[model samples]
Target: MATILYARVSTSEQTLSHQQTQAEAAGFTFDHVLADHGVSGVAVKMKDRPEGRRLFDMLRPGDTLVVRWVDRLGRNYEDVTDTIREFMRRGVTIRTIINGMVFDGQAKDPMSAAVRDALVGFMAAMAQAQAEATKEAQKAGIAAAKAKGGEEGGVYRGRKPSFTADQVAAVRDLLGKGLGVAEVSRSTGLSRQTIYRIKDDPAGASKALEVWA
Candidate 1:
């Protein structure tokens, strides 16, 4: 059985390489590493992501999957729990580094299965709650910053924009040239959702960029 490490990161903090380094530092070795980067846990379902889908197809019975935490596996309660149960059904073992949790295929009896499912459900709910809580906190922080304004007491620029004016311009230019959102994201290194947001509301995006600038 091969040990595969799956890593995922939303734009907030984690990165693929960074996760791998941390796992290694924690002394976990793996035969393969899969990553999904810049994918939002709240918005993107695990099954929909590229690497996530690949990991789903690649894993087989007797394979062991490792992750930094249950959150990396998924953030939606339903999806997370379903995915874990499916993996367990397929004889795949799921392990987490955070709590050193091990969920294996040993749960054959009904009672054992019920207990395992309950635990999975609880963790899945917690993961989704944490993701939502983080989003709410960020929104509140931005709102507070906007209300407080700058040090000079002028209009508050909520937060700095991740993309520069030139980058936004580049995206717009590519869009004007009729490039698809996926292609634009590939060429500009921006997330597909970000491309769609800019594409859908160019005026609003431009206005925000100007305010932040």
Candidate 2:
């Protein structure tokens, strides 16, 4: 019965605020907002992310799940389709603001259902193709870097971390001390919502911290 907006930025340098602004412009009032900062859609599956996992637990039947695109659900075809279909089967309505596309499992008409299914398949395939292309591009870039010497190509110039190592360690310490998320947020400068996410999935938070390091 509520509208939820899920936004993701591959790096800390990238802002989810732009995505939020777009979602708001699309007339979606988010009752809950979940985001994954410094998380790559290509490497992290929806179910594997910190906030992403929480989303699966929080979404309910009749709730509207909005994302920037189908790609936000996954990095490839199979993952994207499977995730969306699973949500639909659970009676959750899925919508994409980018294309103004809506998918619902409650459709009773056979023809409409067929069309929707086909569209999902197409989008899923496109997502996979896009990922493949990006991988190839990265490989090519690395090769070029190697040719020029290890100066540019040795390090993967990937997503930037939202928090520094020191900050992450502090967050972990506060969480380990069993401080409430709100209290942890107040103690640290991080948002209370983000603190709740770290508390909910300490393992994922640890992995994220490793990535930061």
Candidate 3:
């Protein structure tokens, strides 16, 4: 009978507290809060994330799971739909704050059930499509930046990087999770400009470290 709030935070703007506040503003109260920080909803399945896995185990029949949106439940279309259906099957009510949508496996008629299922599929597909579009946009930006860098010069070794190898690795990992430059900079204690450089040409950043060493 408990209610839990789950959040997936990947950017500077989408803090866990921010999500909790959004849910509260929507008039949903939760007994517990769970979050996965710096985790990409597009790249990592919920079951694979540390807190996400805990969420699966913590929730029981009759418990309500609340999220800002359906996208918080999974990495993509199939994952989102399957996870929701599985939760519904478990008798755990799934609620989204955005549309105040509820999926409780309580449809009395086949038409209602079909409509619900269709909506779930549509939302999941949209979530995945949005993720893909963002990723592609990022890739295009990186390519353009890298090309510009190459045009500036090819063999000219720049100044030594301020980041250590570990810092570089952390930057890459955070970037891979789709974190913005400011968020990645804050996480790694690096400057925004350095993070942007890494984001633009990660290989070049690594090469700088190698050439300096």
Top lDDT: which candidate number?
3
Which window of 10 residues has the lowest lDDT sum in candidate 2? 152-161
Report the C-alpha displacement of residue 125, candidate 2, in angstroms: 1.8
**Comparing 1 and 2 by TM-score, which wins?**
1
Q: Which stretches of candidate 3 lie over 4 Å from their true place?
A: 154-213
In the range 11-34, model 1's lDDT, one tens digit per residue, is: 544567777887888788999998
Error in Å for residue 120 of model 2: 1.0
Candidate 2 per-residue lDDT over residues 1-213, each given as its tens digit: 888888876643456788889899988898998887656677678899888899899888999999998877777676778888888988999999988999989878999889999999999888778879988998898777666656645544334445556666788898888886657778888765456456556676667667556
For model 1 the TM-score comes to 0.79
**Using TM-score as the measure, which candidate wins?**
1
The estimated TM-scores of all candidates read 0.79, 0.70, 0.73
Give the per-residue lDDT digits (tens) of candidate 3, residues 42-155: 778889988889988988899999998988786588879988998899988999999898888888899999999999999899889888898899888777776877998753
Candidate 1 residues lying further than 4 Å off, grouped into runs, are: 150-153, 169-205
Task: Give the Å error, residue 173, model 3.
Answer: 17
Kindly report the root-mean-square deviation of model 3 from the true structure over all alpha carbons: 7.0
